[model samples]
Target: MPDVLQQRAGVSVLVCDVAGPPVATTETALDLIGNASFGGAEVVALPAGRLDPSFFTLGTRFAGEVMQKFVNYRLRLVVVGDISAHLAASGALRALVAESNRHDHVWFVPDLAALDARLAASR
Candidate 1:
Protein backbone atom coordinates (compact mmCIF):
# COMPACT_ATOMS: atom_id res chain seq x y z
CA MET A 1 0.00 0.00 0.00
CA PRO A 2 1.07 3.57 -0.66
CA ASP A 3 1.66 5.99 2.19
CA VAL A 4 0.11 9.45 2.12
CA LEU A 5 1.00 12.13 4.60
CA GLN A 6 0.65 15.85 5.06
CA GLN A 7 4.16 17.20 5.01
CA ARG A 8 3.26 20.76 5.89
CA ALA A 9 -0.02 22.47 6.76
CA GLY A 10 -1.90 21.13 3.78
CA VAL A 11 0.70 19.58 1.54
CA SER A 12 -0.04 15.94 0.96
CA VAL A 13 2.57 13.69 -0.56
CA LEU A 14 1.97 10.15 -1.70
CA VAL A 15 4.83 7.72 -1.32
CA CYS A 16 4.39 4.88 -3.75
CA ASP A 17 5.77 1.42 -3.19
CA VAL A 18 6.19 -0.13 -6.58
CA ALA A 19 6.17 -3.90 -6.38
CA GLY A 20 7.64 -6.41 -8.85
CA PRO A 21 9.30 -5.18 -12.06
CA PRO A 22 10.74 -1.78 -12.79
CA VAL A 23 9.04 1.18 -14.42
CA ALA A 24 10.30 1.07 -17.98
CA THR A 25 7.83 2.97 -20.12
CA THR A 26 4.92 5.37 -20.41
CA GLU A 27 2.49 2.62 -19.45
CA THR A 28 4.23 2.07 -16.16
CA ALA A 29 4.29 5.78 -15.54
CA LEU A 30 0.57 5.98 -16.15
CA ASP A 31 -0.08 3.13 -13.78
CA LEU A 32 1.59 5.03 -11.01
CA ILE A 33 -0.14 8.25 -11.97
CA GLY A 34 -3.53 6.57 -12.02
CA ASN A 35 -2.93 5.09 -8.63
CA ALA A 36 -1.94 8.46 -7.23
CA SER A 37 -5.04 10.06 -8.69
CA PHE A 38 -7.29 7.37 -7.35
CA GLY A 39 -5.88 7.80 -3.88
CA GLY A 40 -6.29 11.60 -3.96
CA ALA A 41 -2.60 12.14 -3.64
CA GLU A 42 -1.00 15.46 -4.50
CA VAL A 43 2.55 14.19 -4.82
CA VAL A 44 3.95 10.84 -5.94
CA ALA A 45 7.32 9.43 -4.94
CA LEU A 46 8.96 6.84 -7.11
CA PRO A 47 11.99 5.06 -5.84
CA ALA A 48 15.29 4.95 -7.77
CA GLY A 49 15.22 1.40 -9.05
CA ARG A 50 11.64 1.62 -10.26
CA LEU A 51 12.66 3.66 -13.25
CA ASP A 52 14.48 2.37 -16.27
CA PRO A 53 17.84 3.56 -17.58
CA SER A 54 16.23 5.37 -20.47
CA PHE A 55 14.49 7.75 -18.09
CA PHE A 56 17.87 9.11 -17.06
CA THR A 57 18.85 9.74 -20.67
CA LEU A 58 17.83 13.13 -22.01
CA GLY A 59 17.68 11.98 -25.60
CA THR A 60 14.95 9.50 -24.82
CA ARG A 61 11.38 10.82 -24.69
CA PHE A 62 10.42 8.60 -21.78
CA ALA A 63 11.23 11.15 -19.13
CA GLY A 64 9.58 13.96 -21.03
CA GLU A 65 6.40 12.00 -21.53
CA VAL A 66 6.24 10.95 -17.93
CA MET A 67 6.94 14.42 -16.65
CA GLN A 68 4.38 15.92 -18.97
CA LYS A 69 1.75 13.53 -17.76
CA PHE A 70 2.42 14.36 -14.16
CA VAL A 71 2.25 18.05 -14.88
CA ASN A 72 -0.90 17.73 -16.90
CA TYR A 73 -2.55 15.93 -14.05
CA ARG A 74 -1.48 18.57 -11.53
CA LEU A 75 0.55 16.04 -9.61
CA ARG A 76 3.93 16.64 -8.06
CA LEU A 77 6.52 13.94 -8.69
CA VAL A 78 9.48 13.17 -6.47
CA VAL A 79 12.01 10.72 -7.79
CA VAL A 80 13.97 9.50 -4.76
CA GLY A 81 17.38 7.88 -5.04
CA ASP A 82 20.94 8.43 -6.15
CA ILE A 83 21.38 9.59 -9.71
CA SER A 84 24.98 10.73 -9.53
CA ALA A 85 26.08 8.64 -12.49
CA HIS A 86 23.27 9.86 -14.67
CA LEU A 87 23.91 13.46 -13.75
CA ALA A 88 27.61 13.03 -14.45
CA ALA A 89 26.92 11.54 -17.84
CA SER A 90 24.78 14.37 -19.24
CA GLY A 91 24.85 18.05 -18.55
CA ALA A 92 21.35 18.47 -19.99
CA LEU A 93 19.89 16.00 -17.57
CA ARG A 94 21.75 17.66 -14.76
CA ALA A 95 20.29 21.01 -15.71
CA LEU A 96 16.84 19.51 -15.89
CA VAL A 97 17.16 18.07 -12.41
CA ALA A 98 18.41 21.35 -11.00
CA GLU A 99 15.62 23.30 -12.62
CA SER A 100 12.98 20.86 -11.53
CA ASN A 101 14.19 21.01 -7.95
CA ARG A 102 13.69 24.74 -7.92
CA HIS A 103 9.94 24.27 -8.28
CA ASP A 104 7.26 22.35 -6.36
CA HIS A 105 6.13 20.32 -9.33
CA VAL A 106 8.87 17.80 -9.94
CA TRP A 107 12.10 16.94 -8.14
CA PHE A 108 14.97 14.47 -8.27
CA VAL A 109 16.65 13.86 -4.96
CA PRO A 110 19.44 11.62 -3.64
CA ASP A 111 17.28 10.04 -0.97
CA LEU A 112 13.89 9.89 0.71
CA ALA A 113 15.05 12.16 3.51
CA ALA A 114 15.95 14.89 1.04
CA LEU A 115 12.59 14.49 -0.60
CA ASP A 116 10.84 14.88 2.75
CA ALA A 117 12.71 18.08 3.42
CA ARG A 118 11.91 19.36 -0.03
CA LEU A 119 8.19 18.76 0.37
CA ALA A 120 8.23 20.44 3.73
CA ALA A 121 9.99 23.46 2.30
CA SER A 122 7.49 23.76 -0.50
CA ARG A 123 4.76 24.49 2.00
Candidate 2:
Protein backbone atom coordinates (compact mmCIF):
# COMPACT_ATOMS: atom_id res chain seq x y z
CA MET A 1 0.00 0.00 0.00
CA PRO A 2 1.08 3.55 -0.63
CA ASP A 3 1.27 6.32 1.93
CA VAL A 4 -2.23 7.57 2.64
CA LEU A 5 -3.63 10.94 3.62
CA GLN A 6 -6.19 10.64 6.39
CA GLN A 7 -8.19 12.70 8.81
CA ARG A 8 -7.92 11.98 12.52
CA ALA A 9 -9.78 14.07 15.07
CA GLY A 10 -10.23 16.68 12.36
CA VAL A 11 -6.51 16.87 11.78
CA SER A 12 -5.00 16.14 8.38
CA VAL A 13 -2.50 13.31 8.59
CA LEU A 14 -0.31 11.53 6.10
CA VAL A 15 -0.03 7.94 7.17
CA CYS A 16 3.07 6.44 5.66
CA ASP A 17 3.06 2.82 4.59
CA VAL A 18 4.93 0.40 6.81
CA ALA A 19 6.74 -0.98 3.78
CA GLY A 20 7.90 2.45 2.63
CA PRO A 21 11.51 3.49 2.44
CA PRO A 22 13.46 3.81 5.65
CA VAL A 23 14.05 7.34 6.98
CA ALA A 24 17.78 7.32 7.55
CA THR A 25 18.80 10.84 6.72
CA THR A 26 17.71 14.45 6.87
CA GLU A 27 17.09 14.37 3.10
CA THR A 28 14.58 11.58 3.52
CA ALA A 29 13.01 13.49 6.35
CA LEU A 30 12.66 16.51 4.05
CA ASP A 31 11.05 14.27 1.45
CA LEU A 32 8.44 13.16 3.94
CA ILE A 33 7.76 16.74 5.00
CA GLY A 34 7.37 17.77 1.38
CA ASN A 35 5.01 14.89 0.75
CA ALA A 36 2.94 15.86 3.76
CA SER A 37 2.85 19.50 2.61
CA PHE A 38 1.86 18.55 -0.90
CA GLY A 39 -0.85 16.27 0.43
CA GLY A 40 -2.24 19.13 2.55
CA ALA A 41 -1.38 17.30 5.72
CA GLU A 42 -0.39 18.85 9.01
CA VAL A 43 0.97 15.62 10.40
CA VAL A 44 2.94 12.61 9.23
CA ALA A 45 2.44 9.20 10.78
CA LEU A 46 5.49 7.08 10.16
CA PRO A 47 5.74 3.46 11.21
CA ALA A 48 8.53 3.00 13.74
CA GLY A 49 10.07 0.25 11.63
CA ARG A 50 10.72 2.78 8.89
CA LEU A 51 13.17 4.62 11.13
CA ASP A 52 16.83 3.79 11.03
CA PRO A 53 18.32 1.90 13.99
CA SER A 54 20.56 4.87 14.64
CA PHE A 55 17.51 7.00 15.30
CA PHE A 56 17.14 5.15 18.58
CA THR A 57 20.70 5.92 19.51
CA LEU A 58 20.97 9.47 20.79
CA GLY A 59 24.74 9.55 20.30
CA THR A 60 24.25 9.52 16.55
CA ARG A 61 21.92 12.60 16.67
CA PHE A 62 19.95 11.08 13.80
CA ALA A 63 16.67 11.32 15.63
CA GLY A 64 17.25 14.93 16.57
CA GLU A 65 18.09 15.89 13.02
CA VAL A 66 15.08 14.22 11.50
CA MET A 67 12.70 15.43 14.18
CA GLN A 68 14.05 18.95 13.92
CA LYS A 69 13.33 18.91 10.23
CA PHE A 70 9.71 18.10 10.88
CA VAL A 71 9.48 20.73 13.56
CA ASN A 72 11.09 23.35 11.39
CA TYR A 73 8.65 22.55 8.64
CA ARG A 74 5.79 23.16 11.08
CA LEU A 75 4.51 19.63 10.64
CA ARG A 76 3.79 17.23 13.46
CA LEU A 77 5.22 13.73 13.38
CA VAL A 78 3.93 10.51 14.87
CA VAL A 79 6.06 7.43 15.09
CA VAL A 80 3.78 4.42 15.34
CA GLY A 81 4.68 0.89 16.40
CA ASP A 82 6.40 -0.97 19.21
CA ILE A 83 9.65 0.54 20.38
CA SER A 84 10.01 -1.16 23.72
CA ALA A 85 13.19 -2.88 22.66
CA HIS A 86 14.76 0.38 21.60
CA LEU A 87 13.64 2.17 24.75
CA ALA A 88 15.01 -0.60 26.92
CA ALA A 89 18.43 -0.18 25.41
CA SER A 90 18.81 3.60 25.80
CA GLY A 91 18.09 5.78 28.76
CA ALA A 92 18.55 8.99 26.80
CA LEU A 93 16.10 7.80 24.19
CA ARG A 94 13.64 6.98 26.95
CA ALA A 95 13.91 10.50 28.28
CA LEU A 96 13.59 11.92 24.80
CA VAL A 97 10.44 9.94 24.12
CA ALA A 98 8.96 10.96 27.44
CA GLU A 99 9.69 14.61 26.78
CA SER A 100 8.50 14.44 23.21
CA ASN A 101 5.22 12.85 24.23
CA ARG A 102 4.55 15.83 26.42
CA HIS A 103 4.64 18.18 23.42
CA ASP A 104 2.55 18.67 20.29
CA HIS A 105 5.34 18.53 17.68
CA VAL A 106 6.44 14.90 17.86
CA TRP A 107 4.83 11.77 19.30
CA PHE A 108 5.50 8.07 19.60
CA VAL A 109 2.56 5.71 19.69
CA PRO A 110 2.10 1.95 19.67
CA ASP A 111 -0.44 1.99 16.87
CA LEU A 112 -2.73 4.10 14.69
CA ALA A 113 -5.48 3.72 17.28
CA ALA A 114 -3.25 5.31 19.89
CA LEU A 115 -2.45 8.08 17.50
CA ASP A 116 -6.14 8.67 16.99
CA ALA A 117 -6.74 8.89 20.70
CA ARG A 118 -3.87 11.30 21.10
CA LEU A 119 -5.11 13.48 18.28
CA ALA A 120 -8.58 13.49 19.79
CA ALA A 121 -7.29 14.45 23.19
CA SER A 122 -5.20 17.22 21.74
CA ARG A 123 -8.30 18.59 20.10
Candidate 3:
Protein backbone atom coordinates (compact mmCIF):
# COMPACT_ATOMS: atom_id res chain seq x y z
CA MET A 1 0.00 0.00 0.00
CA PRO A 2 1.87 3.06 -1.22
CA ASP A 3 0.04 6.12 -0.07
CA VAL A 4 0.40 9.47 1.68
CA LEU A 5 -1.38 10.84 4.66
CA GLN A 6 -1.60 14.18 6.42
CA GLN A 7 -1.92 13.56 10.12
CA ARG A 8 -4.41 15.33 12.33
CA ALA A 9 -1.44 16.81 14.07
CA GLY A 10 -0.61 18.64 10.83
CA VAL A 11 2.19 16.36 9.78
CA SER A 12 2.31 14.63 6.42
CA VAL A 13 3.95 11.24 5.85
CA LEU A 14 4.10 9.29 2.63
CA VAL A 15 3.92 5.54 3.09
CA CYS A 16 5.72 3.89 0.22
CA ASP A 17 5.11 0.53 -1.38
CA VAL A 18 7.81 0.99 -3.94
CA ALA A 19 10.06 -2.00 -4.47
CA GLY A 20 12.31 -3.33 -7.18
CA PRO A 21 14.14 -0.85 -9.40
CA PRO A 22 12.97 2.68 -9.05
CA VAL A 23 10.35 3.53 -11.59
CA ALA A 24 11.30 5.97 -14.32
CA THR A 25 8.66 8.52 -13.53
CA THR A 26 8.94 11.52 -11.25
CA GLU A 27 5.16 11.76 -11.21
CA THR A 28 4.96 8.42 -9.46
CA ALA A 29 7.09 9.69 -6.62
CA LEU A 30 5.12 12.89 -6.41
CA ASP A 31 1.92 10.91 -6.21
CA LEU A 32 3.14 9.15 -3.10
CA ILE A 33 3.78 12.45 -1.39
CA GLY A 34 0.51 13.93 -2.50
CA ASN A 35 -1.54 11.00 -1.33
CA ALA A 36 0.11 10.98 2.06
CA SER A 37 -0.76 14.63 2.44
CA PHE A 38 -4.30 13.74 1.59
CA GLY A 39 -4.35 11.15 4.36
CA GLY A 40 -2.92 12.83 7.47
CA ALA A 41 0.59 11.60 7.83
CA GLU A 42 3.53 13.70 8.90
CA VAL A 43 6.25 11.31 7.92
CA VAL A 44 6.84 8.89 5.09
CA ALA A 45 7.93 5.43 6.19
CA LEU A 46 9.23 2.74 3.90
CA PRO A 47 7.30 -0.36 4.73
CA ALA A 48 9.14 -3.62 5.33
CA GLY A 49 8.37 -5.10 1.95
CA ARG A 50 9.70 -2.14 -0.06
CA LEU A 51 13.30 -2.31 1.04
CA ASP A 52 15.28 -3.60 -1.93
CA PRO A 53 18.51 -2.90 -3.82
CA SER A 54 16.73 -1.19 -6.64
CA PHE A 55 14.93 1.08 -4.25
CA PHE A 56 18.27 2.22 -2.97
CA THR A 57 19.85 2.91 -6.36
CA LEU A 58 16.78 4.34 -7.93
CA GLY A 59 15.47 6.01 -4.83
CA THR A 60 18.76 7.65 -4.06
CA ARG A 61 18.69 9.49 -7.37
CA PHE A 62 16.19 11.81 -5.80
CA ALA A 63 18.03 11.97 -2.51
CA GLY A 64 18.98 15.59 -2.93
CA GLU A 65 15.91 16.57 -4.89
CA VAL A 66 12.54 15.06 -4.12
CA MET A 67 13.63 13.12 -1.05
CA GLN A 68 15.28 16.18 0.34
CA LYS A 69 12.15 18.14 -0.33
CA PHE A 70 10.25 15.80 1.94
CA VAL A 71 12.72 16.29 4.73
CA ASN A 72 13.31 19.97 4.16
CA TYR A 73 9.61 20.60 4.14
CA ARG A 74 9.56 19.08 7.64
CA LEU A 75 8.50 15.58 6.62
CA ARG A 76 10.22 12.60 8.19
CA LEU A 77 11.31 9.54 6.23
CA VAL A 78 12.06 6.00 7.49
CA VAL A 79 13.78 3.54 5.16
CA VAL A 80 14.63 0.45 7.17
CA GLY A 81 12.56 -2.63 7.40
CA ASP A 82 14.11 -5.99 6.56
CA ILE A 83 17.22 -4.61 4.97
CA SER A 84 19.62 -7.22 6.31
CA ALA A 85 19.29 -9.13 3.07
CA HIS A 86 19.59 -5.92 1.08
CA LEU A 87 22.73 -4.97 2.96
CA ALA A 88 24.31 -8.39 2.47
CA ALA A 89 24.22 -8.65 -1.30
CA SER A 90 24.95 -5.08 -2.35
CA GLY A 91 28.12 -3.21 -1.63
CA ALA A 92 26.71 -0.20 -3.43
CA LEU A 93 23.80 -0.21 -1.07
CA ARG A 94 26.05 -0.47 1.92
CA ALA A 95 27.91 2.56 0.71
CA LEU A 96 24.69 4.33 0.01
CA VAL A 97 23.57 3.77 3.57
CA ALA A 98 26.85 5.01 4.90
CA GLU A 99 26.71 8.07 2.72
CA SER A 100 23.10 8.74 3.53
CA ASN A 101 23.95 8.66 7.22
CA ARG A 102 26.31 11.60 6.88
CA HIS A 103 23.27 13.84 6.73
CA ASP A 104 20.45 14.40 9.22
CA HIS A 105 17.70 14.98 6.67
CA VAL A 106 17.40 11.26 6.01
CA TRP A 107 17.54 8.25 8.29
CA PHE A 108 18.50 4.66 7.59
CA VAL A 109 17.22 2.82 10.57
CA PRO A 110 16.95 -0.94 11.19
CA ASP A 111 13.21 -1.36 11.49
CA LEU A 112 9.88 0.31 12.07
CA ALA A 113 10.51 0.50 15.80
CA ALA A 114 13.72 2.37 15.29
CA LEU A 115 12.05 4.52 12.70
CA ASP A 116 9.37 5.43 15.20
CA ALA A 117 11.96 6.28 17.78
CA ARG A 118 13.83 8.51 15.35
CA LEU A 119 10.68 10.28 14.33
CA ALA A 120 9.74 10.75 17.98
CA ALA A 121 13.14 12.17 18.71
CA SER A 122 12.81 14.52 15.76
CA ARG A 123 9.65 15.82 17.34
Candidate 4:
Protein backbone atom coordinates (compact mmCIF):
# COMPACT_ATOMS: atom_id res chain seq x y z
CA MET A 1 0.00 0.00 0.00
CA PRO A 2 2.96 2.32 0.58
CA ASP A 3 6.70 2.49 0.27
CA VAL A 4 8.55 0.81 3.15
CA LEU A 5 11.97 1.18 4.79
CA GLN A 6 12.61 -1.23 7.65
CA GLN A 7 14.17 -4.46 8.82
CA ARG A 8 12.86 -7.73 7.45
CA ALA A 9 14.44 -11.11 7.79
CA GLY A 10 17.59 -9.44 9.08
CA VAL A 11 17.75 -7.16 6.06
CA SER A 12 15.94 -3.92 5.42
CA VAL A 13 13.65 -3.79 2.40
CA LEU A 14 12.15 -0.76 0.73
CA VAL A 15 8.92 -1.93 -0.94
CA CYS A 16 7.44 0.60 -3.30
CA ASP A 17 4.99 0.82 -6.16
CA VAL A 18 6.39 2.74 -9.09
CA ALA A 19 3.70 5.37 -8.55
CA GLY A 20 3.86 8.99 -7.53
CA PRO A 21 6.90 11.21 -7.82
CA PRO A 22 9.99 9.30 -6.80
CA VAL A 23 10.28 9.82 -3.06
CA ALA A 24 12.37 12.96 -2.57
CA THR A 25 13.28 12.63 1.06
CA THR A 26 14.86 10.04 3.28
CA GLU A 27 11.92 10.38 5.65
CA THR A 28 9.37 9.64 2.94
CA ALA A 29 11.37 6.75 1.60
CA LEU A 30 11.77 5.25 5.03
CA ASP A 31 8.09 5.74 5.69
CA LEU A 32 7.31 3.70 2.61
CA ILE A 33 9.80 1.03 3.62
CA GLY A 34 8.25 0.82 7.08
CA ASN A 35 4.73 0.55 5.70
CA ALA A 36 5.41 -2.31 3.31
CA SER A 37 7.70 -4.47 5.41
CA PHE A 38 5.76 -7.60 6.31
CA GLY A 39 6.14 -11.35 6.56
CA GLY A 40 9.86 -10.84 6.96
CA ALA A 41 10.34 -9.60 3.43
CA GLU A 42 13.99 -8.65 3.13
CA VAL A 43 13.88 -7.36 -0.41
CA VAL A 44 11.71 -4.58 -1.75
CA ALA A 45 10.09 -4.75 -5.16
CA LEU A 46 9.31 -1.72 -7.28
CA PRO A 47 7.11 -2.71 -10.17
CA ALA A 48 8.52 -1.39 -13.45
CA GLY A 49 5.29 -0.84 -15.33
CA ARG A 50 4.19 1.81 -12.85
CA LEU A 51 7.40 3.85 -12.64
CA ASP A 52 6.90 7.51 -13.21
CA PRO A 53 9.09 8.62 -16.11
CA SER A 54 8.93 12.21 -15.04
CA PHE A 55 10.85 11.31 -11.93
CA PHE A 56 13.30 8.69 -13.17
CA THR A 57 15.85 10.02 -15.61
CA LEU A 58 18.46 7.82 -17.22
CA GLY A 59 21.61 9.91 -16.75
CA THR A 60 20.47 12.34 -14.18
CA ARG A 61 22.05 13.06 -10.80
CA PHE A 62 18.81 11.81 -9.32
CA ALA A 63 20.49 8.56 -8.49
CA GLY A 64 22.39 10.02 -5.55
CA GLU A 65 19.34 11.64 -4.03
CA VAL A 66 17.20 8.59 -4.59
CA MET A 67 19.85 6.21 -3.41
CA GLN A 68 20.75 8.26 -0.37
CA LYS A 69 17.41 7.53 1.22
CA PHE A 70 17.98 3.79 1.19
CA VAL A 71 21.70 3.92 1.92
CA ASN A 72 21.16 6.31 4.74
CA TYR A 73 18.55 4.03 6.23
CA ARG A 74 20.96 1.11 5.91
CA LEU A 75 18.48 -0.74 3.73
CA ARG A 76 18.84 -2.93 0.71
CA LEU A 77 16.80 -1.84 -2.29
CA VAL A 78 15.68 -4.01 -5.17
CA VAL A 79 13.94 -2.58 -8.16
CA VAL A 80 12.23 -5.62 -9.61
CA GLY A 81 10.50 -6.05 -12.95
CA ASP A 82 11.13 -6.38 -16.69
CA ILE A 83 13.73 -3.66 -16.89
CA SER A 84 14.97 -4.68 -20.34
CA ALA A 85 12.74 -2.14 -21.99
CA HIS A 86 14.30 0.58 -19.92
CA LEU A 87 17.81 -0.77 -20.30
CA ALA A 88 17.40 -1.15 -24.07
CA ALA A 89 16.91 2.57 -24.51
CA SER A 90 20.06 3.71 -22.76
CA GLY A 91 23.58 2.54 -22.19
CA ALA A 92 23.47 4.67 -19.10
CA LEU A 93 20.77 2.49 -17.64
CA ARG A 94 22.80 -0.61 -18.33
CA ALA A 95 25.77 0.99 -16.65
CA LEU A 96 23.64 2.01 -13.74
CA VAL A 97 22.54 -1.56 -13.27
CA ALA A 98 26.08 -2.80 -13.47
CA GLU A 99 27.27 -0.24 -11.00
CA SER A 100 24.39 -0.81 -8.64
CA ASN A 101 24.89 -4.53 -8.65
CA ARG A 102 28.50 -4.01 -7.64
CA HIS A 103 27.28 -2.60 -4.38
CA ASP A 104 26.00 -4.63 -1.43
CA HIS A 105 22.87 -2.56 -0.78
CA VAL A 106 21.36 -2.04 -4.21
CA TRP A 107 20.12 -4.47 -6.83
CA PHE A 108 18.41 -4.39 -10.18
CA VAL A 109 16.52 -7.60 -10.69
CA PRO A 110 14.67 -8.81 -13.76
CA ASP A 111 11.63 -9.92 -11.82
CA LEU A 112 10.24 -10.64 -8.37
CA ALA A 113 11.00 -14.32 -8.61
CA ALA A 114 14.60 -13.55 -9.37
CA LEU A 115 14.60 -11.14 -6.47
CA ASP A 116 13.33 -13.95 -4.24
CA ALA A 117 16.19 -16.08 -5.39
CA ARG A 118 18.63 -13.30 -4.61
CA LEU A 119 17.12 -12.78 -1.22
CA ALA A 120 17.37 -16.45 -0.41
CA ALA A 121 20.95 -16.56 -1.59
CA SER A 122 21.89 -13.62 0.57
CA ARG A 123 20.98 -15.59 3.67
1-123, model 3: which lDDT tens digit per residue? Answer: 434343423335555655533433455446555665566666677664543334655445643455665665565556756677767877876887787766666667776566656655656
* lDDT by residue for model 1 (1-123), tens: 544544433566667565535779888788878878887888888886788999999798888999998999999888988889888999999999999988877899887777777766766
Q: Relative to the true structure, how large is the alpha-carbon lDDT of every model? A: 0.80, 0.95, 0.58, 0.63
List ranges where model 3 is wrong by over 4 Å: 1-24, 51-53, 58-74
TM-score of each: 0.87, 0.98, 0.60, 0.67
lDDT of 3: 0.58
Q: RMSD in angstroms, candidate 3?
A: 4.5
Ranking the candidates on TM-score from highest down gives: 2, 1, 4, 3
TM-score of 4: 0.67
Better of 1 and 4 by TM-score: 1
Ten contiguous residues minimizing lDDT sum, candidate 2: 24-33
Q: Model 3, residue 77: displacement in angstroms?
A: 2.4
Better of 1 and 2 by TM-score: 2
- lDDT ranking, high to low: 2, 1, 4, 3
Model 2, span 36-121: residue lDDT tens = 99999999999999999999999999999999999999999999999999999989999999999999999999999999999999
Window of ten residues with lowest summed lDDT in model 3: 2-11
The positional error of residue 33 in candidate 4, measured at the CA in angstroms, is: 3.6
Error in Å for residue 94 of model 1: 0.6
